[model samples]
Target: MKGLALFAVAFTGALLLYATGDFPDWGSLDSPANGGELSTHYIKEVRKETEVPNIVTAVLADYRGFDTMFETVVVFVAGIAIIAVLRDFGNGSRGYPPALANNLPEEPDLIVTQTCNLVIPVLQIFALYVLAHGHHSPGGGFQGGVMLGASYILIALANGVEAAMKILSERKILLMAATGILIYSGTGLVCLLLGENFLDYHVLSRILPTDPIMARSHAMLFVETGVAFTVTAVMFSIYANLATRGTLKGGL
Candidate 1:
């Protein structure tokens, strides 16, 4: 086993080193990507088209909205998959935490619990800031969602998974996950209803009385909100399941 692991690590390193030969030198202006027509197009037109200064955000939430919507669905599906496997569904409890393996209840750490009480609100605040500021800066739905998930995990670590569940029940988590995906795909459906291609943000202009371009930008923000909801719920769901080994009663 150790020998095979060593061989795998060495092979991976060798492959990475060999692949570096095709990569451009550090910050090389003449790199194929820098000079590519696609890159040039995005550089010149993305800001004007999306009205979002952050090029990556514009590309992800606008240019690739359909792809990103499905990507969010993937994240949602993953959470559901884990819940399906770990949750006890034999009885009426479809998604609730399973029973404890033993009778020994976990005691909370006073210091950790008190500190988390102080820190969780701050983390949640930062998460919302990141979600809302993605178009203007270097934060977005996935990043913000992870931060929110971390807050819940901190609570789980400080108190217990059951305590975290009390704050957000299993049903609520599932609801949030589904709701996020709904918001994403629903936006595209709405565009289709307005006589445009799926996810064509300009079609929203028929309803909003704004310029098509600006409407696209605003649509990106709504899409990002959906992403945030699903990502946050899924992250917490996975952690809760793994930390408590499906029971979600106790944790470190």
Candidate 2:
């Protein structure tokens, strides 16, 4: 197994290194990716098409929404899978083997708790900022949701799994995850109901109180929010389940 793994790694690395020779030179204006017909079209048409100043956001949230939605589903599935696999069974206190469970400390560290009290709120605010700011600048749902989840993790580390659960319980996590997926999928269904293709945000203007271009922009925001909700909930759920063997009473 080790030999096969080593050979696979070496072959993959060699292939990648060989492929790099065909890549455009650093920051070359004439690079195929930067100067291609598609790139030129996107550069000229993105703002006019989506009304989103950030081209990356316009591409990911609007131009490529289908891919983004499925990727969110994949992340949510992985989180659920982690819970299914590592979850503990039988009646027992968790976070350690039965033999060690009785020896675990129940009290939280005061210093860590206090520090998190000062930091977590700010962190979550910043996460929301990132999620909302994506249309105009850097950062988006995935990045912001990870940041939001990390704040919860920090709380878990400072206090306990139970403490984290109090902020967002296991049942609520599942609900939020489902809700996010629903928001994403429902948006597509709405587009379909509007007599257009799935995820055709421009068609949303027929039902929405906005212009077609503005409708696309707002639809992208909703899509990003859906992504953020699923990402945040799934991320925290994975951590809680793995850290506490799915009991969610304590986390590392």
Candidate 3:
């Protein structure tokens, strides 16, 4: 059985390597991704069509909205799966194991706690800025959400998991995650109900005061906000579960 497994691994590895030989050379000017008609169209027309200064945001949130929506769903689903498998609702008071308990200090360091207290607020404020300004800049929902979630994780590390949970409780995490998905899906559903194809943001101009192009841009922000909410909730939930061995108790 061991020999058969080894053979299968080697054969698969060889096939994958051989297949890579057929791919275009790295960064070739004529490579499909670089020179394809679709790529050209996006580069030439994205800003004019969507009015979003950031081409990447316009593509992900407008031109390829369905794909990005599913990608967010994938992140949400992964968090849910980890929680379902590892969460221990009834064992909230169970502290860390003996090994971890011995290594950690009984009290959080004053300097570290103070520093985080100062830095965390600034960090979260910057996160909101990133999320709100993404269409016009380099940042976006995923990046902002990560920063927001890291604020909670920093609280956990500086204080304790329990301290962080006080701000973002388990119940809030689930609600925020579900609410993010709802916001994204609801936007598409509204479009559908308005007799436009799902996620067709141009149709939103009928309800919004903006013109068609601006409506698409504004709608993108809405969906991006939804993405940020889910990413923020899921990031903290995963850390809390892993750091606490699903009990969501005690420090890491």
Candidate 4:
């Protein structure tokens, strides 16, 4: 029976890998991706409609904003899961102290540390720039949010997880994650209440007639900011938990 199960598993894995043969070639410039109906339509219409140079950004933030909203929720849920699993560990009395205080050797080399320190600030600034210019370019909430998370991870790797957690407290991270979900959901609900489709920014403009586009832009910005904040915090929290072999004391 065990041999049969193993054979079945291997067969299934091989079959799944074989299925990829039907997929588009890895990077064919003339492939369907470059000339398909959907891609062609987006290529033509995206710039005209969203006025964004980055079609991917326009699609994620505007054309398919609803999908992005749900993606943010997924990230938020993952954060919550990490927090719940580790909450007990942060009993206020037991946790790994900061590396510097713990007297761990300063990571055995300074070059990587110095390089990361210099690059991290620039990366963070670029991440924010990407978020802000998403309306005009190829970056947006999801990409920007992940970049933000990466920035913190770089910091944690440089200084230490404890330092990262100090900069962003676990309690605060939990609250922010919850807040991001709430804000995304609440925006949709508010639109529904206003008699427009859920997340209809046009309807929101009626309340602020003088600056409808601005209002829409602001709402999107806020939503993205929430996403970035939650993602960055949650990622660090995960790193802290994993690095310590799930022995860290702080609650998720």
Candidate 5:
């Protein structure tokens, strides 16, 4: 059995390496992607079709929305998996390993805590700005969510996990994560209900106070906001669980 498995792995690796031989040369102008009408159409017509200035954002939130939505789902699932694997619901202290048990200080450091306090608010505000302006700028939902989650993590590191939990409780984290996916799916569902294909943002023009092109841009922002919500919640939740060994109490 072991020899058969090894042979299978070797065969698969050889097959993949052989397949790569057919790939186009680096930066070849006649490459399928470079020579195709697809890239040309996206570059020339994306702004006119969606009114989203950032071509990448337009492609992610409008052209390839289903793929992006599933990517967010994958992130949420990973967070949930960590919680499932590590969380301990039973009452009372399970006791920490020797490395962690004696390391906690009696009190948080004054300078570190104060610095985090000063920085956290500003960090969170910038995160929101990134989420809102993603269609026009380089920043977006994933980047903003990471920043928001990092602020909570900074609180945990400076003052301990308990302080961070006060702001984002375990229940709140789960709710926020689920809500983000709901917001993304619900937008697509709205489009479907309006007699259009899923994620067809142009259909939103009927309800929104805008034309079709602007509606696509607006819908992209909405989905990006949803992505931000889930990412922010899941980011903090994963940290809180790991730091406290899933008890969500009394850890840095």
Candidate 6:
């Protein structure tokens, strides 16, 4: 009763807040966000510094890359936490059947299975394309990685957890996550070795004869790849644990 009353009050407050004009208009070209203080400066400075056609990608990868690095680490840590909590503590046997262990339905719909079979491959390809072309577009490492992980989930649902796990073994997922972090952090450390600030791409250009803009673009690509790898592995690890109901099934 008290909880229900609280929920009602909270819902009412949310409705009131929505009534206020606090949210920005969708895609308003003349609005301050599109033409105002921050956008004005970003438009002027981003092209001059990064020479990338996609302003959002440039901001995320170059201007505020340190923040992006920490965000990636956060996702990695969340994966580790889920794995630790959900790992089977029992005997060596595949812990439990998916339906019995997870309290999930034994059978899924045919439509879902057929749709997943059709869509998963396309999603995988799209994720890779997004990661590869992030510098020239709105899509980037985080979005691409999530999409990749979603593709794996679709496969797991369409086929089975055991089948998905066979393809993406636990050992491989751990190695991929670790490697992603290492690649990102190692790049920064390499910059430090070259007598520049960590993640400094200007120093990279000195060694490669590429222009500064190109150097930065290359660095962003490397970092994005690392992020995509970690995110994809971590998300799959999470789905595996949940689908198996915290059981360490040898297959899934």
Best by TM-score: 3
The TM-score between candidate 6 and the true structure equals 0.79
**By the TM-score metric, which is better: model 2 or model 6?**
2
**Which candidate do you rate higher for lDDT, 1 or 4?**
1
Model 5 segments more than 4 A misplaced: 1-23, 89-98
- Which residue pairs in candidate 4 collide? 90-249, 90-250
Tens digit of per-residue lDDT, candidate 2, span 1-252: 999999999999999999999988899999888889988987899978988898988889888899999999999899788877776666554554655454657777788789999999999999999999999989898999899999988888888888889989988998998888899989998999999999999999998899999999999889889999999999888888877767776546
How displaced is residue 72 in candidate 1, in Å? 1.0
Point out the higher-scoring one by lDDT: 2 or 4: 2
Ranking by TM-score: 3, 2, 5, 1, 6, 4
Global Cα lDDT for candidate 1? 0.87
TM-score of 3: 0.89
TM-score of each: 0.87, 0.88, 0.89, 0.71, 0.87, 0.79
Q: Sum up the clashes in candidate 3.
A: 0
* Residue pairs with backbone overlap in model 6: none
Residue pairs with clashing backbones, model 2: none
How many collisions per candidate? 0, 0, 0, 2, 0, 0
Error of 5 at 185 (Å): 0.5
The alpha-carbon root-mean-square deviation between model 3 and the true structure, to one decimal in Å, is 2.9
Question: Which scores greater on TM-score, model 5 or model 6?
Answer: 5
Ranking by lDDT: 3, 5, 2, 1, 6, 4
Query: How far off is residue 211 in model 6, in Å?
Result: 1.3
Model 3 misplacement above 4 A = 1-21, 89-98
Q: Model 4, range 70-141, lDDT digits (tens) per residue?
A: 888888788678756755655575665555444556452588678888998899899999888877767766
RMSD of each: 4.1, 3.0, 2.9, 5.3, 3.2, 4.6
Per-residue lDDT of model 5, residues 75-100, tens digit only: 99999999988876665566657575
Instruction: Name the weakest run of 10 consecutive residues (lDDT summed) in model 6.
Output: 95-104
